[model samples]
Target: MWHSPSRRRREAGAANMTRAGRTQDQRWVATAEGEHLRGRRKRDTKPEVTLRKAVHRLGLRFRLQRKVAPRCTADFVLPRHRVAVFVDGCFWHGCPDHSPEEFRGPNAALWEEKIETNRERDRRNTTQAAEAGWIVVRIWECEIRRNVEEAAQRVAETTGSNEAPRRRRPAMPK
Candidate 1:
């Protein structure tokens, strides 16, 4: 069964640790509880809400979590413009600028494998979308949090054009 950090800390008497006599057991318990809380908080973040509001205010029409061609479900899809936007979470997507060393702690091998797989999957998806002639825009959660307007403007630049040129496939060989 999963326990909340507050409950776990209380059960472990985390608040009563003396500065000089802090036992290894108490330290481990506190660290574990802190990591668990951080993971949960990251999962419940509201970056998508802010992005949606900003894009809407810019008068952009887009579909959320919509499926595009070849097994791609983009975070935001502008079908008319053939643009797909992805709002990547820093922790999950392993943001180069913000991913903490803690993510690579404990089960280092397992985390490396998992995060690498996620990165590869993102690359494959982006490549496939581009091959299908869709403009792909990737926005990191941290970037949106830092500046919603800037993130929205980046998205708008990709999809805001009134006339998107049609993509022509190569001519068939004889």
Candidate 2:
């Protein structure tokens, strides 16, 4: 079967448009000649990198993007702690407050459906991990950006096995 150039271009344009409105940069459009290209990182974003670095600085070791099971991968996994951290992109993961009213451009319906599917998958993964005795933590990109240290601290506290010491009551004033 043969496809016309206009149709192919339209399809490609639609695909590109799907990610257009989000704050992410599109560097691959200039390189790819076809509609479908594999192995390209959609949002190998900087916030995630910064968060990872911060976690590392806190002396935390983790597995990056480890596959949990069929059709799911945890963004960061601490096997010993049974903790999984997911650095969710505000746009792609449908952050209730941060996601745009509509996706990058005109293909809002498609993007909405795609994002909803991602959310459903995330829910399923969380459920599966919980069933397997893992603590799942999801941090939005915006949250990390707003207060990376706090977010890191939460992750550390959640993943750390050490029990927090109880506070003693102050002695009665004389």
Candidate 3:
């Protein structure tokens, strides 16, 4: 059957609408919120980097963004110790101490639902990793910022490798 030109054009345009287009079409309470959401980082965030450096200083090695289980990617993992670490943002992860109990504005319900969904996903990821024989260590952004050393210590303690291994330096060439 022959299709009309306008119908064909509409179909073509719809086909051209990709994920970026869908994201652009998302409804935000304010333009600034959209910008903020766009600016959010999925990996290598400041807290994650700080925690990684602190852990490194303790002489621990880890793989970044490794999947310990299906749909579960840890920020970093100590394969040797079978430990997976997730650096979660307080607001995003719905921190009991930091996150607000209720939200306001047009997208208030949406925000609450989003946070609840995030918390549920977090629980699922933790359980999946645990079932896969990986110890999950979740560190809150506030906790890291308040005392990164303490967070690092917690990770080290979880791995049961608090002491840094000695490294041998290369001798000077003759």
lDDT of each: 0.75, 0.73, 0.88
User: What are the clash counts of all predictions, listed in order?
Assistant: 0, 1, 0
Encode model 1's per-residue lDDT on 75-172: one tens digit a residue. 87888789998888887678999876565445555565666787898899999989888999998999998999999988888975754434568999
For each candidate, give its TM-score against the true structure. 0.65, 0.66, 0.83
Q: Note each model's CA RMSD in angstroms.
A: 13.2, 11.6, 4.0
Instruction: Summarize candidate 2's per-residue lDDT along 23-110 as a digit string, tens digits.
Output: 2133322324313433435444677788888877677778888766566678878787888888888877889999877655444466
Q: Which stretches of candidate 2 lie over 4 Å from their true place?
A: 1-44, 103-105, 162-174
lDDT of 3 at 116: 96
The candidate with the higher TM-score, 1 or 3, is 3
Q: Write the per-residue lDDT of candidate 3 for residues 1-174, one digit (tens) a residue.
A: 898655665666765443434333344333577567857999999999999999988899889999999999999999999999999999989999999999986668778888899999999999999999999999999999999999999999999865666576999899
TM-score of 3: 0.83
The count of residue-pair clashes in candidate 3 stands at 0
Better of 1 and 2 by lDDT: 1
Lowest lDDT 10-residue stretch of candidate 1: 21-30
Determine which window of 10 residues in candidate 3 has minimal summed lDDT.
16-25
**Residue 114 displacement (Å), model 3:** 0.6
Maximum-lDDT candidate: 3
